[model samples]
Target: MTTFDLIIIGGGPAGYVGAIRAGQLGMKTAVIEKASMGGMCLNWGCIPSKAFIESAKLFKKVADAKSFGIDGIDKKALKFNWKKAAQRKDRIVMRLVKGVEYLMKKNGVEVINGEAKILDKEHVQVGETKYTCDKMLIATGSRPLRVEYKGIDQSKIMEIDGFFALEEKPECVLVDGGRINACEMALMLRYTGSKVTMVTESDSLIPFLDEEIRKFVMDKIKKAGITVYTKSEITKDAEDGVYVGDNFVECDVILNAKRRRAVLPEMGDLELEMNGHFLKINEYMQTSVPNVYAAGDVTKQFFAQVASAQARTAVNHMNDIKETLDYDKLPVNIYTDPEIAYVGFTEEQLKQKGIDYKVGKFPLSVNGKAMIEGETEGFVKVLSETKYGEVMGVHIVAADATDMIAEAVMAMRLESTVDELARVVHAHPTTSETFMEASYVAADRPVHI
Candidate 1:
């Protein structure tokens, strides 16, 4: 029996960060990971998907060179070596994995390479070895959910996780989710010359986002030549296509972007509280079992771009440096062509909660930088308290909106008023000026239309 002061199961963003913090606090720690050090986000989900998206963007740029006054651009003659693209993504994943391993060594945390199962509250079994610790953290994360339609098997259909195995692009692909992944992939694949169709149960894409932004994204997706079907469900899987209600859509590949659930198969032996399979954690991220903590997608927290934010909160809780996690200021991003980044509540949410709020909106067509960049497509919406003028929420959809929303997030987190943001001087002819304009509009003053 091996013993340590702290033991972490699943070497992911949450587990690795927790282990490092525990080591910094002078506790001996060991982290057990069944697969790679960086887990799904690094190995399969986030990093790899971004790399491919970037490639798709670059390919689109070259394909559209003629629009930039550059003639004799033959996009059909251009070819992509998908094997190289896969290798490029693999290299990035490998580097990040090595970096995680290096951090563990620097923090003097031991690494165990095997699947872990909790024997008791503080004891974990890995293969033939059993280890005990004073405290344990589980950050196993989540896996993509596969819908069990007739003839849809592990062999024919591919979920988001398995979609990365392809060395070549499919001729036609069907994306079966209406949210971020589905919308993004539908646009990217269609732009990259694959006949793509997006099917969703909802009437509009990305239903969680603001209604205005959802409509804008849907229009852009349509303009990209991707067929969009709404309020439809896939009933059966045929040889090369899926039957949605009465119509069968033809496609060579199917991408499932349905809801995901926490991957906690080994938790059956542990005496922990669970809402279905998701581990239930308190405000301090402590599970039902004493000294056992769970974070990231394993917990009941909402899944989005706020994953790292939640991981940081969980790290503080695990280290006992913070008494509670403040989840009020989480920022969410949808990585579409005109990305949507939002922090705090939506107008509908505020209305439902009976919170009186004022809204300010600035369209991208009026922004000088957007017009110059030729990517004018979305808008920035700011919501504030009706009486006090304090910033309640900031939502943006535009080019580099993911990067630009940080300032708004900071302002909202600091409880800054709309007047404060409006008064601040932003650089000339920039997308950031849109924030300033929106803030001004929130105050019922407009400089530029």
Candidate 2:
């Protein structure tokens, strides 16, 4: 029987990262992955989705050339060659896969290309080969969940995974999910001239965000010409398109964004403390079984961004580092036209926790840069503890808000006070000034409204 010091199952972000770290520590490590390296994020989820979004953004820029003081562009009818777009995305994915392979080789981590089945706590079986390890890590990722409904098995109905495989754009697409993926897809396709409708089972889109921010996102989505349906349940049906609550929504494609569960089919032998379908882990990311760690989407944490953070935290713990994973400071990004990004607690969360807080908001219309760019559609909201003036949360919706949230995340993680943020001078005529102004407002000293 072949053996190693560490064995990692699943080749997604967590598994690959852990494997590399283990290899660097001079541990004999082997990673078993059934599919390509880099898992769903590199292959199908994050990278591919972002590639399509980038193309859509470029298409919009070219179509809206007149707004930039450029004329004589009589290209009225813009077309999307989905085949080439998909090919571009696939090439990028291949490059990333090769990068992971290079990392594994450089770190001296053995790569096993096959499906792994857990034979016991110390043993894993891959076809005819069995390997034992002193330590094991289960980093298997997740897949789109299919809801139990009548016509869900039909060809017209699709999941988020199917978006990459689509050779052509659908006439009208019905997207069901209230979170980031659903809103982003609805906007992307709508911008490309597709009739898009978003149906959410919840009361508002992005229910996890602040209620005010959720309302703002809903309004933006509606203004972008995408129909928004809230408090609706999807029933199964066998039709040419998607049906919502018995109404046959004439859609060429139906994208379901219900939820994702951990992919852990080979975990039958090892006992796990599961929160629903997600493996339960402590702050250290240790599972029910000792020396067996679980991270990323496989754990109860549903946030993809948080999953990567947790993976790093788990690595630190494995190396006997003292740092504990703190979800309180994790930043989240929702990739819409006017992107939404936030860190720390929301106003609602603060109220629910009974923490005395104050909120300050600065609209993008006031920012010179936003007006200059003609993308003024969102705002920055900063929350602080009323007594100490310590920054608690920062939420933003604007161009590059996804990247801007990093500053706020750092502030919250460092426990920076509102006064500290207000003291820092931001560049003139920049979107970053919004954060400075919001902090000023939080501190009750606003220079600009």
Which prediction has the highest TM-score against the true structure? Answer: 2
TM-score versus the correct structure, for each prediction: 0.94, 0.95
lDDT digits (tens) for residues 220-263 of candidate 1: 99898888889998877777787877888888877888778888
Alpha carbon lDDT of each predicted model: 0.82, 0.85
Which candidate tops lDDT? 2
Q: Score residue 361 of candidate 2 by CA lDDT.
A: 88
Query: What lDDT tens digits, residue by residue, belong to model 2 across residues 71-123?
Result: 87776667877788889999999999999999999999999999999977899
Q: How many clashing residue pairs are found in candidate 1?
A: 0
lDDT of 2: 0.85
Question: Where does candidate 2 stray beyond 4 Å?
Answer: 151-153, 236-242
Error of 1 at 144 (Å): 1.5
TM-score attained by model 1 = 0.94
